[model samples]
Target: MLLEATDIHKTFQEGRETVHVLNGVTLSLARGEIVSLEGPSGSGKTTLLSIVGCILTPTSGRVVIEQHGVNAQHQGELARVRRQYIGFVFQQFNLFPALTALENIEYALNIKGVKGAAAQREAQRVLVAVGLAERLHFLPRDLSGGQKQRVAVARALAGNSPLILADEPTANLDSVTGGQVLEMFRALAKQENRGLLIVTHDPKVRAVADRVLKIEDGRLI
Candidate 1:
Protein backbone atom coordinates (compact mmCIF):
# COMPACT_ATOMS: atom_id res chain seq x y z
CA MET A 1 0.00 0.00 0.00
CA LEU A 2 1.25 3.48 -0.73
CA LEU A 3 -1.02 5.13 1.85
CA GLU A 4 -2.93 3.74 4.83
CA ALA A 5 -5.16 5.72 7.16
CA THR A 6 -6.62 3.70 9.98
CA ASP A 7 -9.44 4.61 12.33
CA ILE A 8 -8.70 8.33 12.09
CA HIS A 9 -10.61 10.92 14.10
CA LYS A 10 -10.40 14.67 14.50
CA THR A 11 -12.06 17.18 16.81
CA PHE A 12 -11.87 20.90 17.21
CA GLN A 13 -12.64 23.06 20.23
CA GLU A 14 -14.53 26.19 19.37
CA GLY A 15 -15.14 28.20 22.52
CA ARG A 16 -17.50 26.13 24.68
CA GLU A 17 -18.42 23.72 21.90
CA THR A 18 -16.55 20.69 20.68
CA VAL A 19 -16.90 19.74 17.05
CA HIS A 20 -16.22 16.20 15.92
CA VAL A 21 -14.98 16.18 12.37
CA LEU A 22 -13.83 12.66 11.58
CA ASN A 23 -14.95 9.49 13.26
CA GLY A 24 -12.99 6.32 12.84
CA VAL A 25 -12.38 6.69 9.13
CA THR A 26 -10.14 4.01 7.68
CA LEU A 27 -9.00 3.63 4.09
CA SER A 28 -6.05 2.47 2.04
CA LEU A 29 -4.69 3.16 -1.43
CA ALA A 30 -2.18 1.26 -3.49
CA ARG A 31 0.01 2.26 -6.39
CA GLY A 32 -1.70 2.45 -9.79
CA GLU A 33 -5.09 3.01 -8.17
CA ILE A 34 -7.37 6.01 -8.00
CA VAL A 35 -9.88 6.47 -5.18
CA SER A 36 -12.59 9.07 -5.17
CA LEU A 37 -13.90 10.43 -1.88
CA GLU A 38 -17.36 11.96 -2.32
CA GLY A 39 -19.47 13.81 0.21
CA PRO A 40 -21.38 16.97 0.81
CA SER A 41 -19.77 20.13 2.09
CA GLY A 42 -18.37 19.97 5.65
CA SER A 43 -18.45 16.19 5.62
CA GLY A 44 -14.82 15.91 6.77
CA LYS A 45 -13.45 15.21 3.31
CA THR A 46 -10.80 17.89 3.48
CA THR A 47 -10.00 17.00 7.07
CA LEU A 48 -9.43 13.39 6.15
CA LEU A 49 -7.28 14.40 3.17
CA SER A 50 -5.20 16.68 5.37
CA ILE A 51 -4.56 13.92 7.90
CA VAL A 52 -3.73 11.40 5.21
CA GLY A 53 -1.42 13.89 3.47
CA CYS A 54 0.49 14.47 6.76
CA ILE A 55 -0.56 18.11 6.94
CA LEU A 56 -2.85 17.59 9.98
CA THR A 57 -2.59 15.13 12.82
CA PRO A 58 -5.66 13.14 13.77
CA THR A 59 -7.02 13.11 17.28
CA SER A 60 -6.48 9.38 17.29
CA GLY A 61 -5.51 6.47 15.01
CA ARG A 62 -2.57 6.23 12.64
CA VAL A 63 -1.55 7.26 9.13
CA VAL A 64 1.20 5.31 7.47
CA ILE A 65 2.84 6.27 4.20
CA GLU A 66 4.83 3.53 2.46
CA GLN A 67 4.80 1.59 5.76
CA HIS A 68 6.28 4.47 7.77
CA GLY A 69 4.03 5.60 10.60
CA VAL A 70 3.37 9.32 10.70
CA ASN A 71 4.98 11.07 13.65
CA ALA A 72 2.68 13.99 14.06
CA GLN A 73 4.18 14.89 17.42
CA HIS A 74 7.14 16.33 15.56
CA GLN A 75 6.46 19.13 13.10
CA GLY A 76 9.77 18.61 11.33
CA GLU A 77 9.05 14.94 10.85
CA LEU A 78 5.61 15.71 9.43
CA ALA A 79 7.07 18.17 6.95
CA ARG A 80 9.68 15.68 5.88
CA VAL A 81 7.11 12.94 5.41
CA ARG A 82 4.86 15.21 3.35
CA ARG A 83 7.69 16.37 1.13
CA GLN A 84 9.06 12.91 0.58
CA TYR A 85 5.89 10.88 0.14
CA ILE A 86 2.91 13.12 -0.64
CA GLY A 87 1.80 15.87 -3.01
CA PHE A 88 -1.31 18.06 -2.67
CA VAL A 89 -3.73 19.60 -5.17
CA PHE A 90 -6.30 22.10 -4.03
CA GLN A 91 -9.68 23.35 -5.32
CA GLN A 92 -8.38 26.72 -6.33
CA PHE A 93 -5.46 26.16 -8.65
CA ASN A 94 -2.98 27.31 -6.00
CA LEU A 95 -0.50 28.77 -8.45
CA PHE A 96 1.53 31.86 -7.82
CA PRO A 97 0.33 34.75 -9.98
CA ALA A 98 3.85 35.99 -10.49
CA LEU A 99 5.21 32.68 -11.75
CA THR A 100 4.85 31.06 -15.14
CA ALA A 101 3.69 27.45 -15.45
CA LEU A 102 7.21 26.07 -15.67
CA GLU A 103 8.51 28.34 -12.93
CA ASN A 104 5.67 27.26 -10.65
CA ILE A 105 6.63 23.62 -11.00
CA GLU A 106 10.32 24.55 -10.59
CA TYR A 107 9.46 26.21 -7.29
CA ALA A 108 7.83 23.00 -6.10
CA LEU A 109 10.93 21.06 -7.12
CA ASN A 110 13.02 23.61 -5.27
CA ILE A 111 11.13 22.78 -2.09
CA LYS A 112 12.13 19.15 -2.64
CA GLY A 113 15.82 20.32 -2.65
CA VAL A 114 16.12 20.23 -6.46
CA LYS A 115 17.72 23.35 -7.92
CA GLY A 116 19.19 25.09 -10.95
CA ALA A 117 19.40 23.13 -14.19
CA ALA A 118 18.12 19.96 -12.60
CA ALA A 119 14.96 21.62 -11.38
CA GLN A 120 14.34 23.17 -14.79
CA ARG A 121 14.70 19.82 -16.51
CA GLU A 122 12.41 17.99 -14.08
CA ALA A 123 9.82 20.77 -14.19
CA GLN A 124 9.75 20.65 -17.97
CA ARG A 125 9.35 16.90 -17.88
CA VAL A 126 6.24 17.04 -15.69
CA LEU A 127 4.70 19.96 -17.56
CA VAL A 128 5.17 18.12 -20.79
CA ALA A 129 3.66 15.03 -19.25
CA VAL A 130 0.56 17.09 -18.52
CA GLY A 131 0.57 18.38 -22.10
CA LEU A 132 1.58 21.89 -21.10
CA ALA A 133 4.88 22.13 -22.93
CA GLU A 134 3.74 25.00 -25.14
CA ARG A 135 2.08 26.89 -22.31
CA LEU A 136 5.07 26.65 -19.96
CA HIS A 137 5.74 30.36 -20.28
CA PHE A 138 2.17 31.44 -19.57
CA LEU A 139 1.42 32.95 -16.19
CA PRO A 140 -1.56 31.70 -14.17
CA ARG A 141 -3.67 34.73 -15.00
CA ASP A 142 -3.01 34.30 -18.68
CA LEU A 143 -4.14 30.69 -18.75
CA SER A 144 -7.69 29.29 -18.76
CA GLY A 145 -9.14 27.63 -15.68
CA GLY A 146 -8.44 24.17 -17.06
CA GLN A 147 -4.91 25.15 -17.98
CA LYS A 148 -4.30 26.53 -14.50
CA GLN A 149 -5.51 23.31 -12.95
CA ARG A 150 -3.27 21.35 -15.28
CA VAL A 151 -0.35 23.41 -14.03
CA ALA A 152 -1.37 22.55 -10.49
CA VAL A 153 -1.41 18.87 -11.42
CA ALA A 154 2.07 19.19 -12.91
CA ARG A 155 3.22 20.92 -9.76
CA ALA A 156 1.95 18.00 -7.70
CA LEU A 157 3.89 15.65 -9.95
CA ALA A 158 7.09 17.65 -9.63
CA GLY A 159 8.79 15.68 -6.85
CA ASN A 160 7.42 12.33 -8.06
CA SER A 161 5.70 11.74 -4.76
CA PRO A 162 4.22 8.28 -4.49
CA LEU A 163 0.87 9.52 -3.17
CA ILE A 164 -1.24 12.43 -4.40
CA LEU A 165 -4.05 14.03 -2.39
CA ALA A 166 -6.46 16.43 -4.01
CA ASP A 167 -9.35 18.41 -2.55
CA GLU A 168 -12.09 19.36 -5.06
CA PRO A 169 -9.60 19.57 -7.89
CA THR A 170 -12.25 20.02 -10.60
CA ALA A 171 -14.64 22.29 -8.74
CA ASN A 172 -13.76 25.33 -10.82
CA LEU A 173 -13.78 23.58 -14.15
CA ASP A 174 -16.55 22.92 -16.65
CA SER A 175 -17.82 19.41 -17.34
CA VAL A 176 -15.61 18.84 -20.38
CA THR A 177 -12.52 20.22 -18.73
CA GLY A 178 -13.21 18.27 -15.58
CA GLY A 179 -13.46 15.10 -17.61
CA GLN A 180 -10.10 15.78 -19.18
CA VAL A 181 -8.52 16.31 -15.78
CA LEU A 182 -10.02 13.09 -14.51
CA GLU A 183 -8.64 11.25 -17.52
CA MET A 184 -5.23 12.71 -16.83
CA PHE A 185 -5.49 11.55 -13.24
CA ARG A 186 -6.36 8.03 -14.32
CA ALA A 187 -3.49 7.90 -16.77
CA LEU A 188 -1.06 9.18 -14.17
CA ALA A 189 -2.11 6.54 -11.70
CA LYS A 190 -1.71 3.71 -14.18
CA GLN A 191 1.24 4.91 -16.23
CA GLU A 192 3.25 6.38 -13.35
CA ASN A 193 2.11 3.84 -10.74
CA ARG A 194 1.06 6.50 -8.29
CA GLY A 195 -1.75 6.35 -5.73
CA LEU A 196 -4.36 9.11 -5.98
CA LEU A 197 -6.95 9.98 -3.36
CA ILE A 198 -9.21 12.69 -4.68
CA VAL A 199 -11.81 14.44 -2.52
CA THR A 200 -14.66 15.63 -4.69
CA HIS A 201 -18.43 15.86 -5.01
CA ASP A 202 -18.46 15.61 -8.79
CA PRO A 203 -20.05 12.40 -9.99
CA LYS A 204 -17.83 12.52 -13.05
CA VAL A 205 -14.86 11.94 -10.82
CA ARG A 206 -16.35 8.74 -9.49
CA ALA A 207 -16.67 7.39 -13.03
CA VAL A 208 -12.90 7.31 -13.42
CA ALA A 209 -12.04 5.98 -10.00
CA ASP A 210 -11.21 2.39 -9.16
CA ARG A 211 -13.27 2.73 -5.98
CA VAL A 212 -15.70 5.29 -4.66
CA LEU A 213 -15.93 6.01 -0.94
CA LYS A 214 -18.57 8.27 0.48
CA ILE A 215 -18.41 10.15 3.76
CA GLU A 216 -21.36 11.37 5.74
CA ASP A 217 -21.38 13.27 9.04
CA GLY A 218 -17.69 12.42 9.60
CA ARG A 219 -18.11 8.70 9.00
CA LEU A 220 -17.78 6.59 5.87
CA ILE A 221 -21.11 4.98 5.24
Candidate 2:
Protein backbone atom coordinates (compact mmCIF):
# COMPACT_ATOMS: atom_id res chain seq x y z
CA MET A 1 0.00 0.00 0.00
CA LEU A 2 1.16 3.50 -0.72
CA LEU A 3 -1.03 5.00 2.00
CA GLU A 4 -3.13 3.71 4.85
CA ALA A 5 -5.39 5.71 7.15
CA THR A 6 -6.76 3.78 10.07
CA ASP A 7 -9.67 4.59 12.37
CA ILE A 8 -9.47 8.33 11.85
CA HIS A 9 -11.59 10.79 13.84
CA LYS A 10 -11.79 14.55 14.03
CA THR A 11 -13.65 16.95 16.29
CA PHE A 12 -13.92 20.70 16.58
CA GLN A 13 -15.03 22.82 19.49
CA GLU A 14 -17.18 25.76 18.54
CA GLY A 15 -18.07 27.83 21.56
CA ARG A 16 -19.54 25.41 24.09
CA GLU A 17 -20.46 22.82 21.54
CA THR A 18 -18.34 20.00 20.22
CA VAL A 19 -18.82 19.05 16.62
CA HIS A 20 -17.73 15.64 15.43
CA VAL A 21 -16.52 15.91 11.88
CA LEU A 22 -15.05 12.44 11.26
CA ASN A 23 -15.79 9.12 12.83
CA GLY A 24 -13.48 6.15 12.46
CA VAL A 25 -12.78 6.66 8.82
CA THR A 26 -10.32 4.20 7.36
CA LEU A 27 -8.86 4.14 3.87
CA SER A 28 -6.21 2.29 1.95
CA LEU A 29 -4.58 3.42 -1.26
CA ALA A 30 -2.23 1.45 -3.46
CA ARG A 31 0.00 2.26 -6.35
CA GLY A 32 -1.65 2.10 -9.80
CA GLU A 33 -5.11 2.74 -8.39
CA ILE A 34 -7.42 5.76 -8.34
CA VAL A 35 -9.99 6.21 -5.61
CA SER A 36 -12.78 8.75 -5.68
CA LEU A 37 -14.44 10.04 -2.53
CA GLU A 38 -17.94 11.48 -2.92
CA GLY A 39 -20.06 13.23 -0.35
CA PRO A 40 -22.21 16.25 0.30
CA SER A 41 -20.63 19.50 1.43
CA GLY A 42 -19.34 19.45 5.04
CA SER A 43 -19.34 15.66 5.15
CA GLY A 44 -15.65 15.64 6.17
CA LYS A 45 -14.13 14.56 2.87
CA THR A 46 -11.65 17.39 2.88
CA THR A 47 -10.92 16.81 6.55
CA LEU A 48 -9.99 13.23 5.80
CA LEU A 49 -7.79 14.39 2.91
CA SER A 50 -6.07 16.89 5.20
CA ILE A 51 -5.24 14.23 7.73
CA VAL A 52 -4.08 11.81 5.08
CA GLY A 53 -1.99 14.51 3.44
CA CYS A 54 -0.42 15.33 6.84
CA ILE A 55 -1.75 18.91 6.76
CA LEU A 56 -4.02 18.59 9.85
CA THR A 57 -3.91 16.39 12.89
CA PRO A 58 -6.85 14.19 13.59
CA THR A 59 -8.39 14.00 17.06
CA SER A 60 -7.32 10.36 17.02
CA GLY A 61 -6.10 8.10 14.24
CA ARG A 62 -3.15 6.56 12.51
CA VAL A 63 -1.80 7.50 9.09
CA VAL A 64 0.92 5.43 7.56
CA ILE A 65 2.67 6.16 4.30
CA GLU A 66 5.11 3.76 2.75
CA GLN A 67 5.34 1.80 6.02
CA HIS A 68 6.14 4.87 8.14
CA GLY A 69 3.52 5.92 10.67
CA VAL A 70 2.83 9.66 10.68
CA ASN A 71 3.09 11.63 13.91
CA ALA A 72 0.74 14.55 13.73
CA GLN A 73 2.44 16.30 16.64
CA HIS A 74 5.69 16.47 14.73
CA GLN A 75 5.28 19.41 12.43
CA GLY A 76 8.67 19.03 10.83
CA GLU A 77 8.17 15.35 10.16
CA LEU A 78 4.72 15.98 8.72
CA ALA A 79 6.13 18.66 6.46
CA ARG A 80 8.83 16.32 5.27
CA VAL A 81 6.29 13.58 4.64
CA ARG A 82 4.09 15.93 2.67
CA ARG A 83 7.01 17.13 0.62
CA GLN A 84 8.41 13.71 -0.11
CA TYR A 85 5.46 11.37 -0.39
CA ILE A 86 2.31 13.31 -1.19
CA GLY A 87 1.13 15.77 -3.81
CA PHE A 88 -1.96 17.90 -3.18
CA VAL A 89 -4.25 19.80 -5.55
CA PHE A 90 -6.66 22.09 -3.75
CA GLN A 91 -10.15 23.06 -4.99
CA GLN A 92 -9.00 26.57 -5.73
CA PHE A 93 -6.04 27.19 -7.97
CA ASN A 94 -3.42 28.32 -5.47
CA LEU A 95 -1.00 29.47 -8.14
CA PHE A 96 0.99 32.55 -7.42
CA PRO A 97 -0.20 35.46 -9.54
CA ALA A 98 3.35 36.66 -9.83
CA LEU A 99 4.79 33.42 -11.21
CA THR A 100 4.26 32.03 -14.67
CA ALA A 101 3.09 28.43 -15.08
CA LEU A 102 6.54 26.99 -15.69
CA GLU A 103 7.96 29.07 -12.87
CA ASN A 104 5.30 27.78 -10.50
CA ILE A 105 6.27 24.18 -11.22
CA GLU A 106 9.94 25.01 -10.99
CA TYR A 107 9.35 26.52 -7.55
CA ALA A 108 7.89 23.28 -6.25
CA LEU A 109 10.87 21.36 -7.65
CA ASN A 110 13.21 23.92 -6.12
CA ILE A 111 11.62 23.36 -2.73
CA LYS A 112 12.32 19.67 -3.15
CA GLY A 113 16.00 20.58 -3.67
CA VAL A 114 15.95 20.21 -7.42
CA LYS A 115 17.76 23.05 -9.18
CA GLY A 116 18.95 24.55 -12.45
CA ALA A 117 18.58 22.47 -15.59
CA ALA A 118 16.99 19.53 -13.77
CA ALA A 119 14.14 21.61 -12.40
CA GLN A 120 13.62 23.40 -15.68
CA ARG A 121 13.60 20.16 -17.61
CA GLU A 122 11.14 18.50 -15.24
CA ALA A 123 8.86 21.53 -15.31
CA GLN A 124 8.86 21.54 -19.08
CA ARG A 125 8.16 17.81 -19.14
CA VAL A 126 5.08 18.06 -16.93
CA LEU A 127 3.81 21.08 -18.82
CA VAL A 128 4.02 19.09 -22.02
CA ALA A 129 2.21 16.18 -20.38
CA VAL A 130 -0.63 18.54 -19.46
CA GLY A 131 -0.75 19.92 -23.00
CA LEU A 132 0.32 23.36 -21.82
CA ALA A 133 3.77 23.48 -23.33
CA GLU A 134 2.86 26.50 -25.44
CA ARG A 135 1.44 28.36 -22.45
CA LEU A 136 4.30 27.70 -20.04
CA HIS A 137 5.19 31.36 -19.77
CA PHE A 138 1.63 32.56 -19.15
CA LEU A 139 0.60 33.82 -15.72
CA PRO A 140 -2.40 32.33 -13.92
CA ARG A 141 -4.63 35.28 -14.88
CA ASP A 142 -3.97 34.65 -18.55
CA LEU A 143 -5.17 31.05 -18.32
CA SER A 144 -8.75 29.81 -18.44
CA GLY A 145 -10.25 27.97 -15.46
CA GLY A 146 -9.56 24.57 -16.99
CA GLN A 147 -6.10 25.60 -18.06
CA LYS A 148 -5.32 26.93 -14.60
CA GLN A 149 -6.50 23.70 -13.00
CA ARG A 150 -4.30 21.77 -15.41
CA VAL A 151 -1.41 23.87 -14.28
CA ALA A 152 -2.27 22.98 -10.71
CA VAL A 153 -2.29 19.33 -11.68
CA ALA A 154 1.00 19.71 -13.45
CA ARG A 155 2.48 21.39 -10.40
CA ALA A 156 1.36 18.53 -8.21
CA LEU A 157 2.74 15.90 -10.56
CA ALA A 158 6.01 17.68 -11.24
CA GLY A 159 7.36 16.38 -7.96
CA ASN A 160 6.65 12.76 -8.93
CA SER A 161 5.28 11.91 -5.50
CA PRO A 162 3.92 8.39 -5.05
CA LEU A 163 0.52 9.57 -3.86
CA ILE A 164 -1.68 12.44 -5.03
CA LEU A 165 -4.66 13.89 -3.22
CA ALA A 166 -7.03 16.36 -4.81
CA ASP A 167 -10.03 18.19 -3.40
CA GLU A 168 -12.78 19.09 -5.90
CA PRO A 169 -10.24 19.42 -8.69
CA THR A 170 -12.91 19.67 -11.38
CA ALA A 171 -15.38 21.87 -9.57
CA ASN A 172 -14.96 24.85 -11.87
CA LEU A 173 -14.27 22.99 -15.14
CA ASP A 174 -16.63 22.14 -17.96
CA SER A 175 -17.43 18.48 -18.71
CA VAL A 176 -14.92 18.12 -21.54
CA THR A 177 -12.08 19.69 -19.59
CA GLY A 178 -12.98 17.83 -16.44
CA GLY A 179 -12.97 14.56 -18.31
CA GLN A 180 -9.56 15.31 -19.75
CA VAL A 181 -8.14 16.07 -16.32
CA LEU A 182 -9.67 12.96 -14.79
CA GLU A 183 -8.30 10.87 -17.63
CA MET A 184 -4.88 12.30 -17.01
CA PHE A 185 -5.16 11.23 -13.37
CA ARG A 186 -6.24 7.75 -14.41
CA ALA A 187 -3.33 7.42 -16.79
CA LEU A 188 -0.87 8.60 -14.17
CA ALA A 189 -2.10 6.07 -11.66
CA LYS A 190 -2.08 3.19 -14.10
CA GLN A 191 0.96 3.98 -16.19
CA GLU A 192 3.15 5.52 -13.56
CA ASN A 193 1.98 3.38 -10.65
CA ARG A 194 0.99 6.37 -8.55
CA GLY A 195 -1.79 6.26 -6.01
CA LEU A 196 -4.53 8.84 -6.63
CA LEU A 197 -7.25 9.94 -4.27
CA ILE A 198 -9.77 12.53 -5.39
CA VAL A 199 -12.57 14.15 -3.44
CA THR A 200 -15.27 15.28 -5.81
CA HIS A 201 -19.02 15.41 -6.45
CA ASP A 202 -18.56 15.21 -10.21
CA PRO A 203 -19.99 12.02 -11.65
CA LYS A 204 -17.29 12.13 -14.31
CA VAL A 205 -14.67 11.68 -11.63
CA ARG A 206 -16.42 8.65 -10.20
CA ALA A 207 -16.73 7.11 -13.64
CA VAL A 208 -12.94 6.74 -13.99
CA ALA A 209 -12.25 5.59 -10.46
CA ASP A 210 -11.11 2.11 -9.63
CA ARG A 211 -13.11 2.40 -6.43
CA VAL A 212 -15.76 4.89 -5.41
CA LEU A 213 -16.34 5.64 -1.73
CA LYS A 214 -19.21 7.66 -0.34
CA ILE A 215 -18.98 9.51 2.94
CA GLU A 216 -22.08 10.50 4.85
CA ASP A 217 -22.32 12.22 8.24
CA GLY A 218 -18.58 11.63 8.86
CA ARG A 219 -18.53 7.95 8.05
CA LEU A 220 -17.72 6.08 4.88
CA ILE A 221 -20.77 4.20 3.61
**In order, what lDDT does every prediction score?**
0.92, 0.91
Clashing pairs in 1: none
Please identify model 2 stretches exceeding 4 Å from their true place.
none
**Clash count for each candidate, listed in order shown:** 0, 0
Q: Mind giving the per-residue lDDT tens digits that candidate 1 earns over 1-221?
A: 89889999999999999999999999999988899999999999999999998888999999999999999899999999988888888899899999999999999889888899999999999899988989999999999999999999988888889998888999999999999988987897688888999999899998889999999999998
Query: What's the lDDT of the predicted structure labeled candidate 1?
Result: 0.92
List model 2 lDDT by residue over 35-150, tens digit each. 99999999999999999999999999899999999989999999999889988887897998999999999999898778999999999998898889899999999999888998
Q: What is the lDDT of residue 162 in candidate 1?
A: 92
Model 2 poorest ten-residue lDDT run: 184-193
The residue pairs found clashing in candidate 2 are none
- Among all candidates shown, the one with the greatest TM-score: 1
RMSD of each: 0.8, 0.9
Backbone clash total, candidate 1:
0
Tell me each candidate's TM-score: 0.98, 0.98
> Deviation in angstroms for 42 in model 1?
1.4
- Misplaced by over 4 Å in model 1 are none
